[model samples]
Target: MQGVPYLRLLGLVVALTVVTSVIMLIPDWNGEQASTAAPKIDQLLDVAIILSSFVFSVVMVMLGYSIHRWRARPGDESDGAPLHGNTRLEIAWTAIPTAIVLILAAYSWIVLDDMEATASNAMPVEVTGQQYAWSFEYPDENIQADELHVVKDRQVAVEMRALDVLHSFWVPEWRVKRDAVPGAPGSGIDDDFVVTPDRAGTFTLVCTELCGLGHATMRAPVVVHETQAEFDRWAAEQEPIPPEQPQPAAASSA
Candidate 1:
């Protein structure tokens, strides 16, 4: 009888873990993994899901069993047995969770360190965010455009700043996000991050921050060229727009 309950609990846990893992992995939750760091991010998510499923299953099964096994009888109003805490069980639970947390923390630190490592020969692109639009500037080519274009399989270092208010640059496929804060005293001018796109495709770059009335429409197209020559060709075809010249102070009214 003693082993029967343990066997049932073990069966329940295995069943729950399998069902939960399938549900978690079946959905296209994180979307396409286009950047070099995206695969690592997705792996971390899977680890979290597996751990969470086991923890949830254990808690739920124990709680359900306790409620059913200790339920009061239909017409008997009597106090239940006064149970003292089990020191061994308490210590086991505490130690197990602490160990799990430490392991998770260490794994996460490794992933973060690798993701933030600087890449050599990264292409620089300046990004400006405003009330309702995003603009990109290629400093090397001296061209500004509404869309961002980069070479596939190359690292891109983005320097982003907000012209008016706060905004966030997020590309779902790239699995990276950074904030663009206004250039004020003590406030950072441009926040930067590097992303190496592994696939050549069109992605959407949207402002994840709520800045103003037109926040919902603050989005731009991101094009990842399959080859460096293709990107160079596109850049060569683009001409820099000249800055508008102001009239000579209305012919000096005074």
Candidate 2:
């Protein structure tokens, strides 16, 4: 009787959850995890998916069940019975969702904090983005290249800036993206971001933002070397950025 409806609702919710989770949450939805931060980001995504699936399942099941079980009978057109809100149920629903939101907020902060906490020995790479290309500069080594090359299992602090329009630096496997804002040399609208690449492979650095005419073609290669020796070897072969020539004695300062 009453218990039967509850049991059926529970079964429906379970089945719906399984099906939805399989469709939306599983099957490599977040793509490859190649950085230390990637796993944490992926875990957060999984939690979000699970919560949303359950909420959607409960709502849809209840809506359908109520429509079917309480439809008006034939020739019985009349005002529906007045129903008062259940204080306990309302409070429970409000409190539960509030708790879920708080939990998610806390988890999201933790992930960002962990990722933003740069290591003491992290390598620095200045990344510049133009309308249709990206460049990587290793200041310490005085190396410059169109493609990014870094050592695997090492943290890279990306000093990012845009020459013209806004650009975004995104490495799919890293699961993090940061915007590069256009600014003057020392105007300092900072857009610095960091990532620790754990995987040694060739990835692509793509601009997620719609910057302008050649936006679709704005992509560069990223190479993560397996060892310091490999990275050093590559670095030794690249052309160094030419040192800026000193301006002619500043026109005899007043």
Candidate 3:
């Protein structure tokens, strides 16, 4: 009788697990990647989350079922089944959970190591965050601006910083978001990344941090150009077009 209950519980767990695991393949709504490296990382995380959801669902369902099936019936208020726990059941549960933990831990470590390892020697770009705006600094060109421009397939490392309050640089399409904190070193709050744009176009970089009252107004554009030459031309031409001298208002009515 005990074995039958355990089997039923296990079956319920498996069913719920499978259903939730399958749901993991669905795409995330806020996903983006500014570089090829980050998107792959995001995808891996999504997969892991799905797998975890499956496991979680299984555990939850089994727990719920056990509560319902083994609860004291209306007629029985006295002692239930004798307190003789199954050694095999206890060991199986412990061993299986230990094995899962070890496997997941190893997998997570490997993924982290791989992500941090450097890859292609793509050019780097410095992304600076301030109170109410973002500035993209090109290390090679010695220029900074309110907009960021990069070749579609090139690697870009955003060296981030906050002049005042904390700000998070987030680009949905590139799936890259990192905090820009005050007074850090090296890359500071900067996060290294790379992006290969499957489609070339302009995208918005919205500040994910709440710096101040004008936090909602802080935003920038990332222009992904088709070729390096095009990007160079655009970059060369980004100098401010001086504002025309102010003229007096047109003659008022006589």
Predicted candidate 2 versus true structure: per-residue lDDT over 100-183, tens digit per residue: 899999999999999999898889998988889998889989989999999999999998877778999999999989998777
Best by lDDT: 2
Model 3 has a clash total of 12
Candidate 3's residue-wise lDDT over 53-119, tens digit each?
A: 7579766976787797788878887987587777987897798768777877787777666655554
- C-alpha lDDT values of all predictions: 0.85, 0.88, 0.71
**Model 3: how far residue 225 lies from native, Å:** 0.8
Who is ahead in lDDT, 1 or 3?
A: 1
Candidate 3 residues lying further than 4 Å off, grouped into runs, are: 27-34, 79-102, 117-121, 186-198, 240-254
**Residue 203 lDDT, candidate 1, scale 0-100:** 96
| Model 1 lDDT on a 0 to 1 scale | 0.85
Query: What is the C-alpha lDDT profile of model 1 across 1-64, one tens digit per residue?
Result: 1333877987998888878887988887799999999999999989988888888888888888
